[model samples]
Target chain A: MDAIIFLIFAAAAVIFGINVVLRTHPVSSALALIGVMASLAVIYLLLGAPFLAAVQVLVYAGAIMVLFLFVIMLLNAGSEKKSRGAWMARLAGVPLLVALLTILSFVIFRMYPRSVGVKFGSFAAGTVERVGSALFTTYLLPFEITSLLVLIAILGAVVLGYKELD
Target chain B: MPANFVPPSGVEYIRVLPEIILAAVATLIMVLEPLTPAPRKRALGYLALAGFAGALAGAAAAGWRTGPAFSGMLEVDGFATFFRLLVILAGLLVTLVSFPYLRREEAESGEYYALLLYSVAGQTIMVSAADLIVLFIGLEISSIASYVLAGYMRREKLANEAAAKYFLLGSFATAFLLYGIALIYGATGTTRLNGIAQVLSDPRMAPAGILTGTAVALMLVGFAFKISAAPFQVWAPDVYQGAPSPVAAFLAAGPKAAAFAVLLRVFMTAFAPLTGRWLAIMWSLSLLTMIVGNFAALLQTNIKRLLAYSSIAHAGYVLVAVTAHSEEGVQAAMFYLTVYVFMNIGAFAVVAYFSRKGERYVEIEDLAGLGVRQPVLAALFAVILLSLIGVPPTAGFLGKFYIFQAAVKADLLWLTVLGLLNSAVAAYYYLRLIVIMYMKEPGDSLLELPGMAVSTRAALWTSAAAVVVLGLFPALIR
Candidate 1:
């Protein structure tokens, strides 16, 4: 059952990810990206990382997608204009990409054989409790530093967005 | 919870005292900015300067006591203290330069100083980070603040363009870095530098493989981008040219040094065993960076762009030390960076002084007959420029000498020779500025240049004195 679910979500993710690049309009690309994120969330669930799946949906699909949509609307971007370089890129890009993909897959298979197949629930360490404990204990430094990062980001936004008062 | 989980000790707080002080002061500045009146904003600069002084003291105190903190996520060692002091000093100089410029532009606010402090704090974290995840967070914090600071003058179109270009390219580079970290974690099953080293050494745990090689390459690309090394330095000229001069000065000196610190630590400590694997790569990069940077700088008319290329070449020189892979090599690189901060920032301070309002006089020709109009400023600028060319009696000469000596000691004779040749080529451009300042006739409109502000003069003279002092006493940094 987990294998079937994983296959479906993985396929959806790949398709939507491709669409994200292929779409001409900014809004369509953003929507396609959201779809990709959602499908990846489902794949995370199949991998027994339910906490990760929920956070992926909430943070990535929900909050980040909204921000993307807002920016798209604010910019009022139309369909991307087709440039002359596209044909040149297409001629050289596809073959190179295919070669890279083939080499990567070959390496991956050689490194990790089918004996180590990953099945849902075969490794159940990704529970919320486990993650919380790890984050607050071993990863506490990074967890706190993340707040500082966010604070910097907020400060940056305000400095850039607002005008200087006379 | 584990049966015997031990919480971090109270000493961990003291271990990060400099960063803690920086962050607290930055937050205080942010909080006080809105409450204070506009005309009284210079007080904030003084306050920020006080904070930087305190942090510098804190860094000194922490430097005396070195160990891991926050469960080994960060380390307060000699390397970290050296860079933390360098960055704090740079921050202090930048704050001094910004006060007069901000008042002139009517952009004096607590937020500007706050962002500068925050960026310095971020850089401190970066040098001290012992874990890859912590490093990434630090990198993000610094990069974000820098992006905003680059565009601090929102009214200028060039500033906006600079901020956009820097943001896009910086984000791409960071993604590359994070992916590299992920791949390394995948290969070694660890994110801690020591843990990764242990795993690499343990044959039973993991084999030295292709994944690790790829990870190193990717991370090198990221570091190269940050330091503005050749082939990955496309964004720097434009960003530097477009940014406000003081901010550009800070970016060139502080962040570049911090990036070098992290690069040295990661490669030396975490990937020590992979030295043979990465040495050839560093050699080629060092050679290419020197060649491209010096040759490209030769054709630049704009002083800022020329300095940008020079900065890239400086990175190349540092890479030569990294290739040496010795303790003396690392020390040489640190010493070079210390001297570099003084000379480079001093040069930019002069540039900022001559830039006038809205940074109009940045072209090499714009400096014509400056020696006659303001002889002291022009003479000081000459000394700074001479130092940059690695002339005698200036810190740049000693810096280059030490780096080359380390390289020769490592038997990298060819790289040392090539680097010397690049420095020789670099002399032409630095000389051109001096000639323009002294020999050429003043332009018709250049007769009435503004008098130097006390703060600007103070910053310039301090850097100038430091250059000569450090040059004479190179052992001070050593």
Candidate 2:
């Protein structure tokens, strides 16, 4: 049963990875990337890193992807045909597909030996409690620094966007 | 590996006093700007200059000190002190030069100076950053301020274009760097430089993952872009030409120096084992940059664009020094950068002087017979141009001498030879400017010196004197 679930998640990840490149529309490509992120989160859950799965959803899917989408919307992107000149459009997909295939092959080959060490069963080894402990103790400086970074970003945006008073 | 490290107590906060003072002073200037009306705005620049001087003194006071403050996020050491001095000096000169340019360019000068000081504060933090996260943040603060300064002349379309290009390219490079850091974090479960080194040293820690190599290469590319190395240096000429000349001078000098400092520290200390790989990469980059930068500079008619290419050539020379991968190499590169700051900024001040009133662009033809018209300024500019071309009896020559000597000591004889040839090729263009100023007939009947404010004039003459004085006694720095 666990093997079947892993296979399903892996297949979805692969498909979404392909779609992220091949979908002509940037919106579709972005949505496909989100799909890939979700599948990766499930893979993290299966690898006994439940906290990583949650954080992946929260950070990657919830915040960062939304910001990406907002920028896309703010820029008012046009259809895929209008996105780039014909020459750029032709060259873009080739590299994307090539990178995807290369990464896929490498992942498959590298994982073959490690599959035994990576148990597919759900485990509490990387639970929320463990993550909280790590965040507060071992990773405390970086954690606070990350929050400060976000605050700085917010402050920067406000300062940049505000109009000067006449 | 000193496990179970705890954050330092409040006393550690004193370690970053210079940076803190800079930030405070910058904020004070910004807040006081609009409240104090124009004409009084000159006070803002004075305040910033005084603040930067204080910060420089503070940094010098902390000289040669070694400690990891803020949980090893920032390390104060001899290396950091050396770069802090360079950065503060660059900031001081830039602020001084900008006042006259902004007064004439019709832009609000106060905010510009404030932003420059803020950026200097960021650069100070950057050279001292011991962790990847702190480094990234410092890079951002400096870069973002630069983008604003680049486009500070908002009404000028060229300035806007330059800023846009720089911002887009910078953002892409930054993303690549961040992703690289994330991969390193994933591999070692740590972002501290020492911790990463420890993990890489342990044979069992990192299991021959290709991703780790790719991540490092990507990070190198990102840094290469920052310092405007070849293949990633497309933005340098255009951005340098389009931005205001004073800001261009800052970009060419300060930030590039800071970036190289961090790049040297990270690669030499933490990733020493990987030198076998990156040394090969840097060699190609240095050679290509030398050839391309020198040859391209030959065709430029605008003095600013010519200096931009010259800067690229200088970057190549610095990279050759970096390729040495020794203590002497790092020190040589640092010393060379100091000389570079004075000469480059002085040269740009000459160009900015010509651009006053925005009525006349300082084309090569306009410089014809400047030797006759403004003999003193022309002579000063000639010394600076000679220095840039690595001629004897000037600061630039000694800088090149030190770097090449280090290169030879490192057994990179071929690189040193190639460097000599590149300098020879570069001399043609610098001499062309001198010839244009001296030999050619005047295109305009009378070429008056562009009127600069008192401080800008003082800055130009001061930098010129420093270059000649420093050239005469390079041992002072040693």
Candidate 3:
């Protein structure tokens, strides 16, 4: 059952990821990215990292996707134009990409054989309580510093987007 | 659960007192901006300056402590204090230089000063960060504020272009850094520097292998981009040329120094065991950066772009110190940064002063006959330029001297020779600007000189004096 669930989410993730790159219009690509992120969230859940799965959906798929859509709309981005590059680039690129992918898959298979499967409950330390405790205790400094980062982002948007005061 | 998991406490807040003071003051300035009238906006600059002074004092007071804070996510060690003071000094100088320019542009707002303080706050956090995640957050805070500051003059197309380009390239570099952090975390299952150090030291726990190698390389790329080192330094010239002069000065000095601070800490502490592997890479990067930066700087006619390339060359010199990977090397790098803040910013302040309204006088030729028109300003500019050329009795000279000495002590004789040769090449362009100011005749089209503002003059003279004082008394930094 877990294998089937993993396969479905993983396949969906791969398809959406490809769609994100292949789609020409930025809005379409943005939506495809959301789909990919959501599928990754499901995969995270299957790996027993429920807190990470929730954050993946909430932050990446929801908030970050909205941001991408906003930028696309604000910029009024049209479909990407075709470049007039060397034909040699395309000729070399495709074969090189395929070779790189093949090598990566070969390395992955060699490292982790099929006999060592990732059962859902085998490593179940990623609970909300555990994550929250760790974040406030061990990760408190970074957690507080993130507020300053957000404040700077807000200041950046306002300073850049606002009109000059008379 | 591990034994040393301390709960969040009030004392942790005290450990970060300087950051808290800066943030609170920044927020106060922002809040007061909307309430105050336009003519009273100058008060905000004074207010920001006061806050920076307070924070500097706070950092000095806290410098006595030397240990990790907030459960080892941040530290208050000697190194952190050193960078904290340097960052604060840069902020203070930048705020001083920004006053007249902001008023002249009619863009003086609370947000400008607030962002400066906030950026300094971020830099402080960065130098103090003991965890990779904390360092990244601090980096984002500084980068974001700097992007806004770069484009503060929103009406200018150049400012907008600089901001856009900086944002795009900076985010790409940050992604590489984040990915590298993720790889390191995966290998060691911890983002804490000490934890990673332990893991790397113990082969039974985690081997020094391909994952660590790739992670270090990726992180170095990110750091190199931030510091504007060679091959990844394509953005510096454009961004510096386009951004406001004070912002460009701050960018060249403050964030670059802070980036170096974090780079030294992260590489030295977490990857100490892997130094034998990464030192060769640092050596090559130092060599390439020196060659490319100095050579590229020679052809630049625009003053800002020339300084931009010079900044890159300076980064190369600092990288030589990093390549040494010794205690003396780190100290030399810190000393170089301390001197760099004064001379570089002093030079840029003069650029901002002469550029006048709308930044119309940025070309190297714009400085012609300045010696005849305003002798004091021209003389100060010459002093600053001479310092940049690493001439004797200037801060830049001692900075290069110590760095090369440290390199030679570390058996980097070839790198030292190459660096000295690059410095010789760099001298030609810097002296060219000085020659143009003093030797060349004034053109009929020269803009009428405006009277210097008191604040701008103070900033220039203070930085000039600082260059001489720090040069003669190198023990001040020690």
Candidate 4:
């Protein structure tokens, strides 16, 4: 069942990644990026990183991506018009992406074998509770610092967006 | 999620006092900004400066405590303490420089001061971040505030362009960094720095999984962007040239310093096992940044653009020191940063001094006859220029001396020699301004210093004094 879920997430991640790159509108690209984030969260869930998956969805997909969209909308960035003058110049980025994907595939192959030798169940399942325990008990400073970060972001947005006093 | 959560054994408030103070003060300043009158807005700047000084004192008081704060996420030791001091100093210099610059230009200065304080608060948090998540948050806080600060003068088209470019690149970089963090988390099943360190150090932790070399390289790209190392340094010259001088100073000193502080902790403590891979990459980056930055500076006519490239070259020097990867190298990097704050701030102060009402340009030829008309200003300029060129009896020289020694001790002789050669090439540009100031005839419409330029002069003198004093006694800073 876990393997099936992982496979589904893997497929979605690939689709989302492609959409993020292929989309011409910055807003849609940003939305597709969030889709990529969500699928990545699902992958994390399969890896037994419940806390990380939740934070990934909340922070990356929820808060951070919202800011990206807000800024995109505020800026009102238009969809980039397809350029006709130099197809090769624009297509240069495609080859780079293709190379990256090829390298990624090689890495994935190294991580997995057609006939798997190791059992996935043998690994310890780190649940959300264990993560919270580690965070509060062992990593508490960073947690509070994260809150400080949120506070800083709020203050930063206010300072940037607030009207100047007359 | 809460069931298995066992909170770290002890929670300590003293460990995080400096950050708490900065955050509280930043909030206070932001809340009070609207209430402050336009004429008395200068007081807002003073208030922020006072808060920074007080926070520095608090950090000093909390220095060298050898325990983790809020679990093991924050290690409050001499290392963090040293960087906190450096960042606070960076904040102070920026405030001093901005006061004169903002008052003369802006119709509203309150939010400017408030944002400056908030950015400083973010930088403080960055230096003390102990986890990848905290580091990312601190990075965003600094980057976002800086984004606004870059385009603060929205009326100017160049400022708008600079802000736009900085925002686009910064957002892209943050995405890469966070993705890298997520990949590391997926592999180790934890985001805690020490946990990842432990997993990486473990010989049997499935290096084939998230421990792949690609993740490390991706993360390096993220940090390299922040530090303005070559190939990733495309944004520095444009952003530095277009942003307000004080904001540029803040970028050159504060945010960059915080990035290096975090880089030291992240790379040295968390990713020590992968040094064999990263060291080679850093070696190439240092060499490339040195060559490209210096060669580019030699061609620039605008003083600000020249300094921007020079700053990039300085980043190369810091990278070389970082490649040493020892405690002494860390110390040298911190010291270099401290000296850099003075030299770079002083250089910008000189530029601000020459800026006229409604005039932002600092052309190289404008310096002609400056040595004759304003002898004191000219003398100060000479001192700063020589220092920037790493001449003796100035902080810049000692900074280079220490960093080069650290690299040589690490047996990175080639890097040290390359650094020395870059310094030699850099002298041509630094000295060019001096030659124009002292040798050439004054143009008909030489830029005149405004009545309000006294504050800029004061800033210059203070920074020059720091360069000289620190050079005279390096132990004072250490």
- Chain A TM-score values for every predicted structure, listed in order: 0.87, 0.68, 0.82, 0.65
lDDT of 3 at A45: 90
Q: How do the residues B127-235 of candidate 4 rate in per-residue lDDT, one tens digit apiece? A: 8777787778778777888888888877778878998899999889888888788778767777777778888889887466434477777888888888889989999
Candidate 4 interface RMS? 4.0
DockQ for all candidate structures vs. native: 0.64, 0.21, 0.59, 0.40
Best by DockQ: 1
True interface contacts reproduced by each model, as a fraction? Answer: 0.67, 0.04, 0.79, 0.51
> How far in Å is the alpha carbon of B469 misplaced in model 3?
1.1
Candidate 3 versus the native: TM-score?
A: 0.94
- List candidate 4 stretches off by more than 4 Å: A25-79, A84-92, A113-140, A151-166, B1-11, B64-66, B209-212, B444-448, B452-455
Interface RMSD to the true structure, each candidate: 1.9, 5.6, 3.1, 4.0
- Cα lDDT of all candidates, in order? 0.89, 0.81, 0.88, 0.80
Each prediction's TM-score versus the true structure: 0.96, 0.87, 0.94, 0.88
- Per-residue lDDT, model 1, residue A22, is 92
For model 3 chain B, give the 10-residue run with minimal summed lDDT: B1-10
Choose the strongest candidate by lDDT: 1
Residue pairs in collision within model 2? none
